[model samples]
Target: MKFLMSILLVGLSAVSCAQNRVSQTEFKKLMKDPSAQIVDVRTSKEVAEGKIAGSTNIDYFSASFIATAQKKLDKNKPVLVYCAAGGRSASAAKDLKKAGFKKVYDLEGGYDAWKE
Candidate 1:
């Protein structure tokens, strides 16, 4: 029963995470808006592989992640976040929201999904 409850809680968290995520098509549409802010939360090494054109790379793993985001991103605009995989981007989106960003969008399945 405890294991089942844990699974249920994990499933619920996943559902909530999905709510903030967008498919590549939707992400592209959002990107078309001039007010969109693209933030790549991948590490420097991962970014060397290439990123979406026009995205600002902000390493999520860095100790100064939140500080850098606060300094670099506009809280008033819509933020589109992506990482090597979906996990970090999802985390970054939550952090952005807590940091007072009005709109936050995560890349579902991350950059891998985009490449697909």
Candidate 2:
């Protein structure tokens, strides 16, 4: 039972460690880099409100989310993703990882946080 518990903890840790989460400050720093691909995973309506400069909109709810991302994003380069409040970006980061993206950075508090 102890061994099983240990394995479970390790598995959970691995999953959490798979993606990097950054604060608004860290995300802003990353955005300054031209190589980093900034992706806004908010809905089109939300994006129309306002978004981080240089971020490309990719609706998380889109039917071709993954396919569109693959075509628009660089798999080898760093990717910075954010949503309205953070939840969607975290999920998007996981999908980005499974798609073979080397480095995935999720905005800690999403675009709302970025504004603050």
Candidate 3:
């Protein structure tokens, strides 16, 4: 019984910590919220090409990724994250969730999809 209870608790915690993945449409709608913080988790070189307007670039590969996010973003505000593709942003979203951001949204297909 104790083992079963522990498993259930772990499952519940994982669900609570899961970050949301939003489609381009949903992402656009969410961005309309003035309080939302948009984050681009791409390398500096990649971001130099192009990026979402109003997004703050925080390299996911940087050792200070989470720390930089924690410093720049408001924990109380919703965060929308993207990368050149979906991969890095997905990881960033998870990290942001673990860092205790109240709401984290990952852009599906990332900046590529947004451009399309």
Candidate 4:
């Protein structure tokens, strides 16, 4: 019974910690919020080509990715993350949540989707 309860609690915690995945339209609307911190979790080279205006570049592949993000972002504010095509950002969002971010959002289909 105790083991079952523990498993249930763990499952509930996982569900609560899941990051929000937003479509381009929802992402755009959320971006309008002044307090939202937009992060591009792409390589520096990829970011150089183009990125959302006003977003901060924090390479997802960096060894200190989670630590850098924790230092750079405010825990209280909403964080909006994107990658080239939704892959890296999804991973980054999970890391952000594990690092104690209360509200983390991933851009579905990433920059490609937004550009379309």
Question: Whole-model Cα lDDT per candidate?
Answer: 0.91, 0.90, 0.91, 0.91
Every candidate's CA RMSD: 4.0, 2.4, 1.8, 1.9
RMSD of 1: 4.0
For 1-116, candidate 2 gives per-residue lDDT tens digits of: 99999999999988775548888878888888889999999999999999998899999999899999999999999999999999999899989889999989999988888787
Best by TM-score: 2
Candidate 3 lDDT over 9-109, as tens digits, reads: 99997776453888898999999999999999999998898999999999999999999999999999999999988999988998988889989999999
lDDT of 3: 0.91
Cα lDDT tens digits, model 4, 15-115, are: 76453888888889999999999999999999988999999999999999998998999988999999999989988998998899988999999998787
> What does candidate 1's lDDT look like per residue over 1-116, in tens digits?
99999999999987876778998989999999999999999988988988999999999999999899989888998999999889999999998888888899999989877877
| Model 4 lDDT-worst window of ten | 13-22
Sliding window of 10 residues with minimal summed lDDT for model 3: 13-22
Residue 62 error for model 1, in Å? 0.8
Q: What is the Å distance of residue 89 in model 2 from its true position?
A: 0.3
Provide backbone clash counts, one per model.
0, 0, 0, 0
TM-score winner between candidates 2 and 4? 2
Q: Runs in model 4 with CA error above 4 Å?
A: 1-19
Arrange candidates, best lDDT first: 4, 1, 3, 2
Error of 3 at 30 (Å): 0.7
Candidate 2 backbone collisions, by pair = none
